[model samples]
Target: MKQYTLLLAEDEPFLGKVVKESLEKKGYAVMLAPDGKQAWQLYTSFEFDMCILDVMMPYKDGFTLAAQIRQANPKIPLMFLTAKADIRDVTQGYASGGNDYLKKPFSLDELFLRVAELLKRASPENQPADEFTIGSYSFSPKRQELKDSDGTIVKLSHKESQLLVLLLQNKNLVMDRKATLLKLWGDDNFFNTRNMDVYITRLRKKLHKDPAIEIVNIRGFGYKLIC
Candidate 1:
């Protein structure tokens, strides 16, 4: 059986432990981060199928982290856990790139259901492409590698590879900022937005060798990959 990777960001120690254990019991690989900042770091460093973020945290907030994640990989599923149940808070959560929001003091059953639903929704849409040609760059999504005509191989981080795949899957379409944030980082906030900028810069640098490959910023919208 294939195990899905889940990143859980929560500051409360006891709750984090319980959540991790529960998910692990279900055969999911769970990585727990004590704070939003650490969560963002873990997310960028590894590949996670879905993210569950706690709205409030130290150093960086969940929303901010989610925004950053969106900028890097726009097609991942994002869910939020929070105590605030006000309409404004829910709306804000959605605005910040949350696909689903769960209020605090909830049951373990609810959590499990939500996680399962997200994982199901995030499952890859179609069969993975064996090879992709973008300008002078050749990409193998399965291997997460990009090679140039000169035989120079550029390895991509998990998030980088995932982002590229999403862009290629939706080629010629404008992937909106909110959609990307919700999918990747699991939330959209100020800090996450900054993090996204960094990833975008890194991606641009990696593709700089190919003039025909352009990742364009559409101002108030999202990004467009032109090949």
Candidate 2:
């Protein structure tokens, strides 16, 4: 079994302590933050396999923190722990890059289940291969790097690497748009759709070094990577 590290950001002292201890006992390395600001600090200072965040907190909010984290590491799994029941709040959580949402007064057993599922989905072992070859380029999704034919290495964000891997898998075939959004962003909402478009543009620029390689927009469908 692989060891996982989690970042828990909840302002409530009792809740934070209880969750931390409970997760630690489950064999995870847990780092608890009393506020969103501290959570951001911890996120920058350390690497975490996943983040469990409370929507309401002092100095900053979980949604804001989540956006920051997503920008820094787009592939990391994030879950929201919130008391807000509004449908808009739930929508906002997904828009801000949360992979899961758990309401307050929830059971520890439920939390454990969600955590396990999210980690499993994002686990590297689930990938078919650590590296993939594109036209005139070698891509290592695990390392988030793309090596050009001339040996110039380009660093990629977690999101970019994930997208590249999916494109590779469906090379020359149209990868379904809704399915891609759901798999990467955990939602098929308009916001995630637009976000995926942005990532697609980023990938195009990154892979443009190889004239033989092209990522084509399927127009009302998905994308196809041509090599």
Best by lDDT: 2
lDDT of each: 0.83, 0.90
**Local accuracy of candidate 2 as per-residue lDDT tens digits, 112-161:** 97799789878877655877899989999878999998999999998898
Identify the runs in model 1 with alpha carbons over 4 angstroms from their true place: 126-227
State the lDDT of candidate 1 residue by residue for 47-112, as single tens digits.
999999999999999888888887788878788888987767766776777778877888989788
TM-score of 1: 0.56
Question: Over the full model, what C-alpha lDDT does candidate 2 score relative to the true structure?
Answer: 0.90
lDDT accuracy of residue 115 in candidate 1: 84
Off by over 4 Å in 2: 127-227
